[model samples]
Target: MSKLSPGEVERLKNSLKEKGYKLTPQRRAIVDIIIRNEGSHLTTEELYDLVKKDCPEIGLATVYRTIQLLEDLGVICKLDLDDGCGRYELVHQEENHQHHHLICKNCGKVLEVQADLLEGLENEIESKYDFKITNHSLKFYGICSECKNIKNK
Candidate 1:
């Protein structure tokens, strides 16, 4: 899925309610920013900064707590984008599937791509060891074009 649709958000809220988790304002704001910054791979601190722009009264403690709760509810996925920041993104129901991020070491930029391209390895693992694949993360580290040109001088 591209991002959480209005229907998806309402469905998520209802699901969370069923699981005994309420979608309070704090949680809503936190999730909204995560969805807006879909591919940005934002850390909780970064998320808090974004939220504070709209809800100045939101505390970092609350952001932290809400992030954990939302994560537990499967509305988003926590990512260690290999940039020293634990980031997150909304779990888009229509998207291909969860994937890993590629980080530009010199620029600290993040790019998300599908993990399906690794089917060869996935099959190898299953065939060789009967490991029945479920999921995995693969991060690549490199200097992006801009950084490469800057350092070439």
Candidate 2:
């Protein structure tokens, strides 16, 4: 994914504005951090600590608020990953966000793979069954590479 341009940020602000979500200082700062750091599947508390470097007065509640606002605006995607806490990541417009996760049950490592890997099966399922397919999310659970090796040793 590409780094966000100034134009994109402005567009996002305008988009949220229409939704009645004011681009407050805390919200912008939080969004800016997420944009600047790509590929960060961060938790709310982690984002709060990082955002504190720029705005120490920011509260955890504020972070949570911003995250929800962003998600509502389709600016970011939230993933549960079947973990204890939810994680957040900036959603790329180029990608359809149609993918599955490979999660290591032992160590909780989650990696995303494009949904195309299941293209034939998805198509077959739709043809053989009676369901309109709009979108889907799949998650495979297993032990991670390191954990597998550890067991062998």
Candidate 3:
């Protein structure tokens, strides 16, 4: 009943082993919750709330530790929306850089932009400045269509 694919589970296991850590059941439950809510951008407290539904005995400290461990192992990454809280999402294997986010200023809804819209800009900057680009994060703030529609009504 694991949310993670077998391959993903094995990969996590191997990564943990490489770091001399074991994937305990509690850790597994936490990871399952993260995978279940892939785009949630969950904060540690939010994650703990969801994880508690499955693991009533799990502590917030455990969630914090596991999150740090997973981030350290590159299984996930932290995101700061400048909203006074740090959020987290999975580190997709296929993406060279994290996808951009569009945050609604009025309603505070966050939308993901799957396309890497800055590729050309990155290339231009690299060629112009002779700099190597490793990665980048971008977030746009504006009113979403829903908010605009509501306002226009």
Candidate 4:
């Protein structure tokens, strides 16, 4: 079941309205899937397939358009995990920046690091370089503990 609340849906509706768009049924299904699989980092094709199960008559082009619309509205963001595929994840409203990702090299699993571990570094760089950092994306790749444990066994 989706963790999306009614308030969140209303907020999304308001966002779309502000952008001269509407939350159609197909679009709602896509958004529902995205919310349900919050950390899945689904690709456009993966999202399309999942939406097809719910909206059998939906077209790929419509999915693409909705993705573009949502992205333009800053409701989602694209991530590159160096896997030759672009993945999409929601831009959490409460987060000042997107959380970092830890990708397991062996099992190809991705874990989210909720801690903002780069504040000091970002501050140092901003002061030294006279730059104002607005946002950043970081990905760390390594073998996860589960993989290491399996290897030891």
Candidate 5:
């Protein structure tokens, strides 16, 4: 697993301080896990399991609270892919490159659409509707190639 860089860690710590939140060990551990697994889109339970390996004393309630706090602080993003559980990924502070998701309806596999597919749409919306597009998420649901092949077989 990748580790958080010193600069990234400090940035997160500073953000917590600005919000009147102390960087406790448990909170740091959770943040570390999230940053390390940057694109994993981990759920609360998934995070809890990974965090437990480092700090077995940490409780699920604590993880949930920490996740909520991080989300509130804009340190992490909450994603709902219609998977009946909230998934999370670190907020990319540097770039505005927000990727969309393609979900397989039959097998529930999530593939990341890496391109900024809505730039034109956002520009049009802003121009026509007088709205500012700060951020957006789009999910396309369909059968993946593997699932389609299975049906053909």
Candidate 6:
């Protein structure tokens, strides 16, 4: 989790204000936690637990609402890894880059694949089908190295 710059914080605040949402203290705390744990891909329960440690008065419902708001505002992305739980991560405002995910079947550990592996494929698809590709979610599932080693042993 990397620290967010002051400008990034202001951008988020302004975006919220434009959407008729105030940067409430609780909401700010939630954003802070998400920003601090930037790539954690945390579930609602996990986020609630972490937020509760900081603001014990916060409720699960409030966390859920805040998460929905953030997602609607494009400040965070909701990820479905086919594990029966929705995960979330901050949307990198500066880059707006999309990365793929690798989920280990045995241990359920999710790893990020940062390379832009679909650029050529996207170009071909657009040219061949005459349809534009706006976004994509690509995930690969298999046993990770550690799990493979354990199975071998």
The predictions' CA RMSDs to the true structure, in order, are 2.2, 2.5, 1.7, 1.4, 1.8, 1.3
Question: For candidate 4, lDDT tens digit of each residue in 24-142?
Answer: 99999999889889899999999999999999999999999999898888888999999999899988778888899999999999999999899999999999999999999999999
Which portions of model 4 show Cα errors greater than 4 Å?
none
Writing each residue's lDDT as its tens digit, candidate 2 over 1-153 gives: 446678877878898889887788899889878876655568888889999999999999999988988988878888778777888877666665456778898887777775457767778998989766766667889988899999999
lDDT of 1 by residue, 1-153 (tens): 255678988988898889887888878888778877778778889999999999999999999988887788778888876556788887766644577677798778777766458879888999999898766778888878788888998
lDDT of 5 at 98: 56
Q: How would you order the candidates by lDDT, starting with the best?
A: 3, 4, 5, 6, 1, 2
Off by over 4 Å in 6: none
**What ranges in model 5 sit over 4 Å off?**
1-3
Please provide, for model 5 over 1-153, each residue's C-alpha lDDT reduced to its tens digit, 9 standing for 90 to 100. Answer: 656668877887888999898899999999889977877889999999999999999999999999999999887889999989899987766748557889999988888887887789899999999999888888999999999999999
Higher TM-score: candidate 1 or 4?
4
Q: How many clashing residue pairs, candidate 4?
A: 0
User: How many clashes would you count in candidate 3?
Assistant: 0
| lDDT per model vs. reference | 0.81, 0.80, 0.92, 0.91, 0.88, 0.88
- Flag regions of model 1 displaced more than 4 Å: 1-3, 95-97
lDDT at 62, model 3: 98
Clashing pairs in 5: none
Model 5 lDDT at residue 41: 86
What TM-score would every model get versus the actual structure? 0.86, 0.81, 0.95, 0.93, 0.89, 0.94
When 4 and 6 are scored with lDDT, the better candidate is 4
In terms of lDDT, the poorest run of 10 residues in model 5 is 90-99
What is the TM-score of candidate 6? 0.94
Can you list the residue pairs that collide in candidate 2? Answer: none
lDDT at position 12, candidate 3: 94
